[model samples]
Target: MTPEEKLQHLPDKPGVYLFRDTAGEIIYVGKAVSLKNRVRSYYQSGSRLSPKVRALMNRAADFEYIVTDNEVEALILESNLIKEHRPRYNIYLKDDKSYPYLRVTLGEDFPRVHVTRRVVKDGSRYFGPYTSAGAVHETLDLLRRLFPFRTCKQKLAEGVMSARHRPCLNFHIGRCLAPCSGQVGREEYRAMIREICLFLEGRQDDLVKELTRRMNEAADKLEFERAARLRDQLQAVRQVLENQKVLSTSKEDRDVVALAQNHDLSLVMIFFVRGGKLIGRDQFLVLGAENTPEEVLTAFVKQYYVRADFIPGEILLAEMDPQERPAIEEWLSGIRGARVRLVVPRRGEKKQLVDLAAKNALLALQEVEQEQKSRGQGRDACAELARELGLENIPYRIECFDISNTQGEESVASMVVFEEGRPAPGQYRRFKIRTVSGPNDFASLKEVLTRRFTRAREERELIQTGQLSTRQAKFYQLPNLVIVDGGKGQLSAVRKVMKELGFAHIPAFGLAKEEELLFAEGRSEPIRLPRDSRALHLLQHLRDEAHRFAVTYHRQLRTRRNLKSLLDEIEGIGPVRRRALLKAFPSLEEMARATVEELAAVPGMNRAAALAVYRFLRG
Candidate 1:
């Protein structure tokens, strides 16, 4: 149906609505309590809409929606769809990093605990979304000391554990109970798991009490060894609790949030409080947040809590609209499976906490602004380089290329990007030389340039015709400048390829490593800048980074090839066994030093296979 017709038939219930462009690409996603009235408001001619909405409507050709059971479900589904599609007109969280979590494999016969960055629906209990990896490591270390649980990746089923005759190094070091070898009973392991869960949940008082009770019970039974062990654990828990600062008298879990915005950039700080104590805080930088503080807070609340493992009972915000408070609370309560309150404290300790968070946010914003100013020096350097080279456009986005090879074996090329004078590692790319043969750097460079530009032109056309989304075609856009690693020879090679590909207008240059001189196309002599010039230093940094990236990739390929060759030489070692050996041991040196029993413990490896690999590596 047409846009107007779909609006006419809209349902009057809570749901998520999607606006699609002519190519059927979703450009906007929104949640509404009353879909009929909410969707109709966008089309009413007399009503005023924001400029962003007007722009979205101008490109919107069709619309679709999904009916949810309630407003909470609609809010959840809207967040998921927006994150998945990353619609252009939505307030997207641009950071791509995932926080670490402590995962407990409760489904296994012998459960194991470890740190992971992903959350899957696999019957596991996750304890955290910790912002600092170091903090997670420290916690894991403390847990290992307090509880002797197994840390290996062995499939410790009842049948598998019964077959193991020897324990690993962890057993000798007293760090693991060696469940893989049946050294620990299921009930004993489960008790330890309970204690670990309590510790991670920040219930130190309960954990200490349980440990003390167990210690006394062991003492009553005349089990001195067990009593001593429990006593040590209890002491550790008490010590950690002593270090934590209690912020409130009531044992309530809550989070305080504050935001600071300067122009289009915003910084948000959230302090996590559990058991009435402040545990940790996390800061996020939001770009393109062109809205009121209340609106920004609303968007952040809806988006942030979806990935959180634990939702607090109360969320203290610096500012929020009264109309949106109830809806946000409902959504949070649905996710948490309990009642949640969204509060804007006017006075009290909670208000003081919010103010402290606001101060932190403002300080963080200042640091970001200072960093941007430092980056401005890089931009100025780029402009200076443009003036020196007599180019039309300033080189805000520069791409450098380098090729690495050793006698034509495992040849590879690297592409490094610099945006606004900072290295954009996410945009870096590597290519394995396919068409070139036998150490011909020039031909390898040519092949890489041709493939890169050809794809760029095709993606540009697709974007202009509205056949491809801008998000998908981001890496295909042309750079403002191109730098090659060698002198005049590499510059000429790149220029020929660009001319053949109908991109002659793109400025090209080369930097020679020996003399640190720049070579531009059609220039008779190389240009040399002063030793202290920022423009020359920027070019050198780019060239060195490209070279380093290319060398790293070349070494990885060479090492893998060498490993495969050595494995192929051993008798009775097929592909599966080869893969298992590689997975168990990272390098040839490690494999050579591994014991037969250790090698045999790996999956798909038998005693005979282990002996063969050990003998081959030793020989």
Candidate 2:
């Protein structure tokens, strides 16, 4: 549908809108207080969106919306839709795990403590969407120690309704109240629940005082065991509360925000607090962002906290956003249970929190900037390389192929990937030089290039269909240029493979080691780089890395054979034990003197066998 037709159909009510691409895939999702006005704004006069937005709109096939009762409902619906579809243009919370909450399911006659990733609007009380699993585990531990909440997954799943046959380890350790076996009455369990709720709601001091009073009463009644147990729990709770005093003292809800920017990236840190206690913190680092403090500050807030698990009473920012602040505050207030405020403190304790968060973000951005700066020099040198080879563009990510072996014995092919002129070690690949019997560089080059280009062709199709094959995709993407460590014949060999793979468009060239010269496809004479040119240096670096990678693989094969030969000399060790030892450790150097206990852990090597191997190696 055209923009005008869609705008006319939109309702002036709060809702979520979807932008579909030419292939009918949802490319973007957004929430608006008034669907008609917001959707139409894209086509209104004098209103220009970003270049990215314009590109998205140009490809947009149609739009769709779901009207809601209120802005709050729209906000909630938008979050759900974004999660379900994972629209490309949406600022996504990428983790597959749901935002967690501490759930106290009291609907049952017997209450249970559980950690849940989702927050449902059920009658049960929920505490948090804690960002860290470690924090959640620690909180559960504290609760179990204080209130005798069940910690066993099996017991909880089984719903210990009647009681357990025997009090488990938790009861003996005083971590559980042991009501599951009917040791504690319902009235007593209810009282413990009240105290737990109080403690969770930031009334720890009062709860402690009341518990101490109850303990004294129990002692007066000559209930020594009950009083003793209460005493232990009270001390534990006090210690936990004391340890949490370092971060804050107010016990009020607030979020600390900070921003950092580099030449092409930015980072934001958001610290969430509830009841004046630190709950969790999230850090967001954005790529391809420019170095403007105000723009970075604005983008960080809008992009990072749009789907915040918990909205605070106040948002504390390191820098102010004058224009976007009003819109953000309005949007946030609708989602939060109560009024939400946005502040940029000039000088105070709150400001200090923002400052610390900002400093951390700045350090992170500085590290990224340094890395990018280092890569910039490499990329510039590669640009010179493209010019030297008379190619279309800079070889930012170049792939080089080489063959290795001793006269075709254990022959292998190696492909090394370089990104922005630096070796991407993880992307280095090895092939067994299939379809070639003898030590023919020509045949080896054709086989390796065909395999590489064929996979590249298939993956490009997959990417277009929004189904990337794997982490290996970047290596398979047609490089800006290709390099081989040989003369004109090797270059032609790769060119023929590219033709067979239907990818003749990819430029293939070779750098012969003897003359230190480059030869491209269809060229008889070689092209050489200027002795002092940075481009020449970059090309040489790539050639050297590819050569090193190929030679290293050959050396490793030789080393493994040597190690196997040594193992064969030892009578007790066979192929099974040899494989086990090698698999268990990184290298022979580390496994050279492994202890009996360590050696026994390797499969097929028991204590006797392990000792025998150890003694043999030691001797």
Best by lDDT: 1
The parts of candidate 2 lying over 4 Å away from their true place are 1-71, 77-255, 261-266, 271-315, 319-345, 366-384, 392-397, 404-411, 419-422, 433-447, 450-476, 496-505
Q: List model 2 lDDT by residue over 210-240, tens digit each.
A: 8899789889999999899789878887787
lDDT of 1 by residue, 98-213 (tens): 77889999998889999998789998888766656887888789889878888888787765576356776566556677887788778777888988888777666678888888
Backbone clash tally for model 2?
A: 4
Instruction: Score each candidate by Cα lDDT.
Output: 0.85, 0.73
221, model 1: CA deviation in Å? 3.4
Question: Residue 7 CA error for candidate 2 (Å)?
Answer: 13
Task: Look at candidate 1 and tell me the lDDT of residue 148.
Answer: 82
User: Which 10-residue window of candidate 1 scores lowest in summed lDDT?
Assistant: 90-99
